[model samples]
Target chain A: MTPAVLIEKLQKRYGTVEAVKDVSFQIEPGEIFGLLGPNGAGKTTTLRCLCTLTEPDSGRIEVSGISVTEQPRLARQRLGYVAQEIALDKVLTGRELLQLQAALYHLPRAVISDRIESVLSLLGLQDYADKKTGTYSGGLKKRLDLAAGLLHQPDVLVLDEPTVGLDIESRLAVWDFLRRLREQGTTVLLTSHYLEEVDVLADRVAIIDQGVVIACGKPSELKDRVGGDRITLRIREFAPLEEAEKAKSLLQTIPTVQEVIINSSQGNSLNLVVSPQSDALLTVQKVLQEAGLPTFGIAQSRPSLDDVYLAATGRTLLDAEIAAAGTRDEKAERKKSMR
Target chain B: MSSTMTSTKASLNGKVAVAQTPSSANPVGDFFQETIALTRRLFIQLQRRPSTLIAGIIQPLMWLILFGALFQNAPQGLFGDNVNYGQFLGAGVIVFTAFGGALNAGLPVMFDREFGFLNRLLVAPLSSRYSIVAASAIFITAMSLIQTAAIVAMSAFLGAGLPDALGLGLVALIVLLLVVGVTALSLGLAFSLPGHIELIAVIFVTNLPLLFASTALVPLAFMPIWLQWVATLNPLSYAIEPIRYIYLHDNWSLNSIVMQAPWGQVTLGTALLILLSFAAAVLLSIQPRLRRSLA
Candidate 1:
């Protein structure tokens, strides 16, 4: 069967910045495919290309069997796009906006009213349907946006950071709605920076960094591929660098200890990766105890998605996000997104 | 297009087809459905927020009253044979009001872009992007007619005299041509400008100056030789002159000379053609820009 959405060798550049560089991925039907990355990772650019909001510099993008570059209208017809920003007309009520969206997608007038009602109900937005969108809270606005995107019954719903600024209650509501959509067999392609969000929702995931797909597979598969059981030990609530360093050196001597990282951001917590085995955690504890390292708290678990990212990219996702934040030229990115 | 639409259905047939319809595959039907729906949206916005319409009507009436009064006492025969200053000013006000309103046709779209509302429209499978342009043109033309009707009524009440049935018809035709051209240019600017602030700045700079430079404020005869030439050359003059003729003369015909510039005599028929060409030129000029942005 043709993939619901296929993007191959996708490349998009904004001026001198190569926003999407040689990225490629295919989203199968009936699964939530997550594009996980930091802010400037070219996720938005790739989505823009797929949505036909921007033409790719050179790439193959297809919605169903329709090549986006060749027949954009058809691709658009099958793809429902909920942009990162909730872009509702303030003067228009929720129902009015959905009605307009139905029209733009060319739903038959006879069915438009029903479609609008169904979508609003599905998203729990019926309460706010007649109220001006300007009066909506952030969650209501997002729900309305999602309703508009789904009003056309698009085969593939392409969402760009759907729950970015939503409150916890609203975010869970959105997540539940997405799961229901999958149960109905609609394919979902979403971009998110939240590690837990991707872990929980994505049936398959692609971790992208700097315009490249670093890893792609089931979340469990990717996490296990990094091949280690992890230990995060805080010698104290806020361990000093000296104590954390002393613990790190002692823990490294264990033959099962594959790697050790001192996480300064978490109050100098020692993050250890040991060969997967029943006694790896016990072995590390015994080694640390011999060196007089007091373990205020300790936990052991399989490597997480973040560990996979760290193994592949040499820095933790949070650290990369922080570095990217400092270096990102927001004014420049705004100009790129403007068109 | 057929394969694309069908492929989506085929893959999701197992369970997602719950929403499927018997006639889901018709592209032509869907296209019309969407375009009409999109057009209806603009109408709804206009209905709910009638301020733009209200303001569009009021500004022109104010122009007719205050501006007409400013030149009310001009020498009796100065404008033309048997034509009062108020009569002469009627056409200018009609054209100017339509022009000003048309000049702002892009404002809504510009605001949509800034607020990311255009992205919503862009994401939809619009049968043709031209529908976006068509919707704005339709909205502005409807607005121009309303403003024109008000100006005609107020001018007639101010002793400027009414046009004949045929003359009134000509007035609408002129308004349509002028609005179509100006709306096209405005939509082009809406796409080309970086933000609404920049678009508004362009509108502010271009709006009144174009009105003043044309015959909207005064007739060509009272101006200097160079000014007369400039006014006659202005596209707004082409619209203003013929409508002005109908307001002042019930005996007006296509062959009647409506404006005399330093360059030559411009008949009512010639003026219409000039406005047509101006509309066409403005429409053609923006195609590449619109295609780049909208495509």
Candidate 2:
């Protein structure tokens, strides 16, 4: 079977900034694919190029085997896109908005009402169908947007950051809905900054950083590939930088300890990667005590998706996000080139 | 195109993965479906809000009553023989109100762009993006005519009197033509401009100046020679002079002189022809811009 979505050598530049540089990925039919990245990592740009909203500077994107740039209308027919920001007309009621979406996708007049009813029920929007969307909570608004996207019953559903700023319950509800979609054989592709969101929903994940896909695989497989047991320790709730650095150097000398870094953002905690040591947590606590340092907190766990990110990028995902948010130039943001 | 999309769907009614490889894809049918639905959305917006439509109707009536009173005591024969200020101001108010309404055709589109609602439309599988442009033109033209009807009714009640049925029809046609041109230009701006603020600035700067320079307010004889040239060149004046001719004259004909411009005399027929050419020219000139943005 043809891949539901394929993007190769994708690159988009707004002036000197290469928003999507050499990014490529493909999703098999019925698979949930996630493009995981930080805020300025170009996930949205890649989705835009695939959806034909913005032309890529250089890339080949296919939806159900249709070239997005060559036969955009046909490609669009095969893809349903829900952008990161939900764009509902406040004055339009939920039902009316769906009707408009139905017409836009060129649904036959005869089948439109049936399709609308099915989607409304699927999203549990029956009770709010007649109510104007301005009164909807964030959850209801997102559900309505999703229903509109699915009305055409596209082969693939592409979402950009499906659960940003949503309440936990709403986020889970969206995730459950996506899982159900995959069960029904609809291919799914989404971009998300939330690590757990991708880990939970995507069958296969791609880690995008600075417009490049640094890693892609099943979540567990990627984590195992970067194999290590993890330990998080802190000298105090807010350890001094000098103490954290000293602990980092001392931990580095241990045979069981593979690597250590000071996580300054998290109250100067120390994150360590140790080769499968059963007493890794106890070893760290003993070393701290030996150095006249008090262990405020310590824990051991298996590697997480964040460890895969850390192994490749030398920084945690949260740290990358903080750095991106701080260093985002307002002028450059202005020139980010919206469609 | 078929070479690119090879999804072999047995049915196209419900599943749109390939969007009707239905053996008979009608582009015209798809265009009409989307355009009508989009136009319906605008009408629904008007029905729910109603405030903008209310203000639009009330504002023109105020212009008629207040402006008519402002010139009520003018000397006789100042505008024309046996013509009252109320009678002369009726056409100006109608034409100017429609012009203002037409100029605002882009405001909603601009807001959509700013708020990302347009992105939804952009990513959809539209048969032709011109449907978006067509919808705005239809909605604005209909709005201009509605406002025109309200003004004509109020002017008649104010003792300005009504024209014959044919005259009224002609008034609607002139307004429709002018609105079409201005609406096209405004929609072009909506797509080309970066955001809503810039589009609003363009509307603000052009709104009153064009009204003042046109024959909407005064006859060509009342202006200086340079102003007469400006008024004759103004498209709004062409729409106004014809409708004004229909109102003031009982035996109106196509060849009847509507205004004496600085260049030469403009008959009712010449005024309409000029309006026609203006509308056609604007529609053609803005095509490239619309195609760039919508394509």
Candidate 3:
């Protein structure tokens, strides 16, 4: 079967800023594909190009074998995009909004009502169908947005940060709904910064940073490829920089320790990557003790998705997110998204 | 609910094979369906929050009543033969009201852009994005007609006198022509402008100046020669003069002289032809902008 979505060398630029640079990925049919990235990482831009909302500066984007750039309408017919912002008309009620969406997608007149009803119930939005959307809470609005995106049942559903600004329960509800969609054989592609959300729901993940796809694979496979266990240790509640550096150097000398970095943002805690060994934690404790350092807190865990990102980008996702957030021009972004 | 849900889900799943293909067989049918649905949404919004319509009606009535009263005691023959200032103001008010309404046609579209509601429409498999333009034109024209009716009725009640049925139909046609062009220009601005604030600023700067430059408030003869030239060149004047002629003359034809402009005498037919050309020129000029933005 043709891939559900194919994006090759996708490059998009907003003026001088290259929003997407050399991004490529292919998602199989019926797979839940996640584009995991921090803010300003060009995830939204890639989705926009695929949805034919914004033309890419250079690239090929296809939906189910139809080229989006060459035949946008046909590609659009095969894809349903739920943008990061819920774009419902507040004056329209939930049912009325769905009706409008149905007309937009050109759902058969005979089945429009049935399709609307299915999506409303699928997202548990029946009771609120007749209520104006302005009165809906954040969760209800999101559910209604999901309902709209699913009305025509396109071959693939593309979502951008589907759970942002949602409550935990709503987020979990969305996750469950996406899982059900995949079970029903609808291809799902979503972009998210929430690591666990992608790790838990996505069958395959592409880690995007600074407009580039640095890593892509199943969550477990990517984690295992990083090839180490993570050890986080705090010498004190707020270890001094000098003490943290001393601990980092001492930990680096250990035979099993592959790398050590002092995380200054976390009160100068020491993060270590150690080669897999049953006695890795014991060895770290003993080493600290020998150096007359107190271990206020310590934890050992298998490599997480964040570790995969770190291995690829030389920085934690959180650090990249903070650096991205500081440099983002919100006004320019809003202007770009407006059209 | 659960049973309905289950049946719907089962049916949807059963038809998944067919659903993968495109659903639209008749492009024309799909176009009309989407356009009407979009048009219906605007009407529904107008129905729910009637404040805009309410204010739209009230503002024109105030212009008629207050402006009529302000110039109520003017000398006879100041405007024209056997005409009260109220009679003179009726055509101006009708033309201005419709012009103002059409000028504001972009606000909804601009708001949609700002709120990202337009993105939803853009992402869909619309038969043609021109339907978005059509929906706004239909909605704005409908609104302008309703306001025109209210103003005409109030003007007749205020003793300006109603024109014949044919004359009323002509008035509607003139308003429709003007609205179509202005709405096109406004929608073009909605797409080109960065945001609602900028669109609103353009509307603010252009609104009253266009009204003042036209012959909406006074006759061409009452103005200075340079002002006469300006008023005659204004498209709103073309729309106003024809309606004013039908109101004043009981036996008016398309060839009846409506105004004496500095350059030449313009008959009712010439005025309408001018209005038609103005509307066509504006609509034509904005096509490239609309196509670029919508594309």
Candidate 4:
């Protein structure tokens, strides 16, 4: 079967700035494919190109089988986009907004009402349907936005930063809603900076950084590919250099421990890379106790997507986001998103 | 909490909407449906937050009442007719109000663009993105009509007698032509301008100068030779002069002289043709800009 979405060597630039460069991916049907990256990492730009809101500088983007660039109207029929910022007309009631959306999509008159009703209930927005969107809380607005996007029953629902400013409860609700969407067999493509959000909700993810895809795979597979479990042990809070080195040496002797480094920035904590699924935390505690070094804290876990990002990009996602934050031009970014 | 609130009924029910086969497509019907639906959205907005429309109608009444009082006792035939100052100012107010309304037609679209609502419309598979333009034009025209009726009634009550039925129809046509033309230009700017601030700045600078340069407040004979040339060149004069003639003449025709310019007499037929050409020129000039943005 043809992929639900196929983006090949996608490139887009705004004046002197290259927003999406050499990015490509294919999403299969009925799977939640996530584009994971920090802000300004080309995720929104790639989605804009895919949604036919912006013309790509170069490359191919197809929705199912239709070329989005050449047949945007047809592609648009199959793609429902919910933008990051809620775009509700505050003067319009939610139901009225959905009716307008249905009409815009040219859904048949017979089914528009049913579709609106079903989506409102499905997103748990039935109670708020008659209220003007201006009165809704942030979470309700997002729910209503989701309802509008799903009203026409698109083949792929594309969301940008679905839960960027939503509270934890609303975020979890969105996550659950996405899972149910997958259960009902709709292809979902979303871009998010929240690592756990992607790991918890996405079936397959592509981590994009600085206009390029650094890693792409199942979350667990990407984590495993980056190698080994991590164990962070502090012999004592703010341990001296000699004690940290001693703890690192002691931990390094374990057969399951692959590597150990003293993290000087975090009070000389020892970071260990152990073979996957090993009980290295227990072993490290015993080793430090035997050496008369007090164990203030110790923990071990499987490598996370952050580790995969670190292995691929030499910096964590958080660090990249902070770096991007300092340089983000809100005005230019808004202009690029519109028109 | 949300997961337990409902099952996935949305997908189950969406089959009905999706079963709409591509083979059953109707492009013309789609265009009308989208246009009417989009137009309905603007009206709905007006109904809910009526401050704009309320102010739109009320401001023209203020102009009709206050401006009438401002020059209540000008010399007889000062505005170049057996008509009083209020009679001539009636047409001016009608055309000027519609012109003002139409010139600001792009502000809402600019807001939609800034708020990302335009992207919502753009991303949808409409019959054509021109529906966006069509919707704004229809909404603004309807709004201008309401204002025109209010001004016409106010002028008639103030002793500026109503025109014949055909003459009133001509008045509407004139107002519509001007509104449509100015609306096209405004929407063109909406798409080309970067943001609402820039668009508002352009509207602010364009509004009053065009009004003063036209015969809205004074006849061409009252101006210096330089200003007379400028007023004849202004399109608002083309819209205003014919309506003013229809209001004053009991027997009017397409060839009846409406205004005698420094160069030549502008007949009713020529003025209507000029307004038509102005509308057509604006529609054509804005096409590329609309295509680049909406396409």
Candidate 5:
């Protein structure tokens, strides 16, 4: 059989903004795949195209070998989309909404009740099933949304930023629920800007940036591919530019150091990428001491996904997030999302 | 490499559930199943939050009583031959109330779109998304009928005089056709407009204007030449004239002249045909918008 979801040469444009450009990925059945990107980084756009909410200007999207463009109804049948914003009729009880969902998916009457009960129980929503969703807390609403998405037992469950705006407890519950879903052999695809969320839950992740897939692989493999350990050495708490430059120049002479970047944002701290070794830190400290540079603080660790993002994009994820946030026109985006 | 493992895993899971047919057992059966399911949702909303429905019925009754009292002292025979202004206004109230309620049929859908609830529906394996539109139409039509009954009773109590049973039945047919047409236009607006705010603004702008321009509050002969022209041309007048004719004339027939438009006279049967055509036209006009938005 074909992969659970296959998207090839996906390209979409909104006005002059190329929201998703040349995005392609195959999700193996039963694996949790993550599309990772900061805000405005085309993650949601990709999900929208996959879920058939928006048509791609050019691309092919397939779910279970069915072309979504040509046979959207069939593809939609195979896909369950959980949007970032949980939408539930405030007046209706949770059970009522689920009943509606059962109908929309056309579940057989004989099994609809059993399926609703099972899914509600699976999501721990049995106690709150009779209450109006308007009274539900953020976590309860999300759980209800999850229950709605899974009501049909779709072949692939697609979630867009599922845990955003959720509290820590609710976030953990969502994560646990997703893990249980994966264990049951459902293909899961989710998008998130949170590095750790993707790191922990996703079996494979694609890092999208500027409407392109910059890197994709197992989290550890991507981290390893970036190579080496990162060492952040500060000459002083507020090092002078000259002092930071001197330390950076001194560190450059070390053969173990492959790359050195001065982080001016953090009081001129030196960020060094050094080949993995047991003695790299000691070697750096000794060199700094001989150079009369006092070490205010230093940390060394294996490269993380953030480090991979930094190495590949030349900017940290945090920086990209801030930039993306500033440039995003929320009003315009909300309008675009309406239809 | 992992592909082989996935296939094995999928088959393994498939065995646990024998009837692992991805497609429904029968698509034809599933279509009705889902359509009913979707329609049931709209009804549940009405059951739980009956406020809109309550207000829908009450507002028209209020218009009948308040407008009737306002015009109680009007000169006798001012409305038309052998009918009080209150009775003349009754048909207008019944038609206007249903028309106003139907005009708002799109608000819920607009809210759904803004809240991203529509995205949830679109993502589902719906037989056709038109089921969403159809569900709205069904719900609104039901509400219109209830309001129409309430208005009919209130009008008779106010001594506006009751139409005979057949006359009341004809009034319902007129209300249903008008509601169907207006509801379709409203739903089309809901899909076409960018947000609920815009939809409300359109509803706000269109609501009272349609009422005032039609024969809802005044007789066509009572208006200025231009206003008379507007009243005659208004679709609401097409609906109002037939229902008004049935209320005043016990021995009504299709050939009876129901309305004296500025341009010409419209017979009772011709008025029904016009309302039917209006409903069909509105439904057909919105098809492209629905196709693009729902597609």
Candidate 6:
């Protein structure tokens, strides 16, 4: 079977800036695929191209087997887009907005009402359907947006930063809702800057940076390929830089530990990468104890998605995000997204 | 959550199964459905917030009452044979009100674009993106007609006198043509301009200048030679002159000379044809821009 969504060598540029230099990914049916990237990493640009909102300068994008560039209307029928910004018509009641959405999607009149009812209830928005959307909280508005996107039962649902500013409860609710969508056999593609969100929700992920896809695979597979266990050990609640350096030096001498770095942001905690061993945590504790370093907290686990990003990009996602933020032109970006 | 998911999954499967057969769908039927639905949205907005329409009607009535009184005591026969200032001002207010209201048709669309609501419409499988344009045209035409009715009534009450049925019909046709054309231009600007601020600036700069340059506030002969030439070329002149002729002349025909321009005498039928061409030209010019933005 054809992949639910496919993109190859996608390239787009805005004036002098190369927004998406080279990116390629394919998402199979029934999988939750995540495009993980920092703010200016061209994740939104790629999604815009796929949704046919903006045309790419070069490359192929397909929905199921339909070419998005050649047969956009047909592709649109198969794809549902929930934008990062909640685009609810505040003056319109929830049901009215859904009704407008149903018409825009050309959903058959006979089934439009029934479909709207189901999606509203599915998102637990039945009680709020009659209320004007301006009265809704952020979570409710996002839920209504989701309902609008799913009203036509699209084969692939595309969302951009689905839970970017949502509270923890709302974010978790969105995660659960996405899982339910996958269970119902709708392929989902989402982009996010949050590594933990992608790690917890995406079945497979593509980590993009500076207009390129650096890594793509199942989250667990990517983590495993990074090839080590992470041990974050705090020498004390707020260890001195000298103490952290001393712990790093002592920990680096062990045969099992392959690397040691001081995480200054977290009270100068020592982050260690060790070769796979059953006694990795015990060995680290013994080394710290021998150095007369008090272990305030310590944990060891398989490598996380962040470690995978770090291994590929040489910088943490947060650092990339802050750097990207400094360089982005908000006005230009908004203009690009508008049309 | 698990139980709800299970039940939803079953129903969703059923719904998808029903929607899978796309072969029987009718494109033409779907286009109308979407257009009507979109048009209904504009009407609902107008209904809930009636301020725009209310203000639209009241503003023109104020102009007629205030301007008519301002020029009421001017020398007799200064405007034309046996014509009161209110009589001449009727046609101008009707045309000007429609022009002003139609010029604003893009504001809603611009707001939608800024707010990201236009993306929602763009992402959907629209039968033809022109439905957006069509909906705005329909809404503006309806609104112009209502405002025209109010102005005509107020003008008649102020002693301008009502036109005959055929003349009233002609007045509406002229207003419709003008509104459709202006609305197309505004919507085109909405898509092409960067933001609402820029769009509003254009509207503000264009609104009063166009009104002043037209034959709305003064007769063509009453102006300086340069101003008369400018007014004759104005599309608003074509719209205003014909309606003004039908209101003043008890016995009028297509051959009736309605305007005395420096170039030549413009007949009622010629003025209308000019208005028609103006509407067609604007609508055609915006086609490429609409395709670039909407298609």
Query: What TM-score, to 2 decimal places, does chain A of model 6 have?
Result: 0.93
lDDT of each: 0.84, 0.88, 0.90, 0.89, 0.86, 0.90
Tens digit of per-residue lDDT, candidate 6, span B16-73: 3355322245668668988998998899889888999999999999999999999989
Q: How far off is residue B90 in model 5, in Å?
A: 0.6
True lDDT of residue B214, candidate 4: 87
Q: Put down candidate 3 lDDT per residue, B228-264, tens digits, no spaces.
A: 8888888898899999999888899989998888888
Clashing pairs in 2: none
Docking class of 6: medium
List residue ranges in candidate 2 displaced over 4 A: A329-338, B1-24
**Sort by lDDT, best first: what order?**
6, 3, 4, 2, 5, 1
Q: Least accurate stretch of 10 residues (summed lDDT) in model 5 chain B?
A: B1-10
Across residues A1-339, which tens digit of lDDT does each residue of candidate 1 receive? Answer: 999988899998888888889899898999999999888889999999999888899989998888988878778878889999888888789998887786776665676777777777788777889999999999999998888888878889999999999999999999999998899888999999999999999999999999999999999999978987998889999988988888888888888888899988788988888888768788877877887778789899988899988888888888888889999998777656665
Share of real contacts kept by model 1? 0.55
List DockQ for all candidates.
Answer: 0.40, 0.52, 0.57, 0.55, 0.47, 0.50
Model 1 chain B scores worst on lDDT over the 10 consecutive residues at: B4-13
Off by over 4 Å in 1: A234-247, A264-268, A277-298, B1-32
Candidate 4 CAPRI-style tier: medium
- Flag the better candidate by DockQ, 3 or 6: 3
Residues A1-339, model 5: lDDT tens digits: 689999888999999999998899999999999998889989898999998899999988999898988988778877888899999998889999998887777665776777788888888889999999999999999999988888777889999999999999999999998998888889999999999999999999999998889898999999989999999998889999998988888899999999898887678998899989757899999999897789999999999898988888998787898888889999998888887
Candidate 1 per-residue lDDT, tens place, B98-167, comes to 9989999998888777777888888776766788888888878888898899988988898888878888
Cα error, residue A183 of model 6, in Å, equals 1.5
Question: What fraction of correct interface contacts does each candidate retain?
Answer: 0.55, 0.59, 0.67, 0.74, 0.65, 0.59
For candidate 2, give the lDDT of residue A74: 81
Candidate 2 lDDT by residue in tens digits, B50-90: 99999999999999999999999999988899988999999
The lowest-lDDT stretch of 10 consecutive residues in candidate 3 chain B is B1-10
State the iRMSD of every prediction, in order shown. Answer: 4.3, 3.5, 2.1, 1.8, 3.3, 2.0
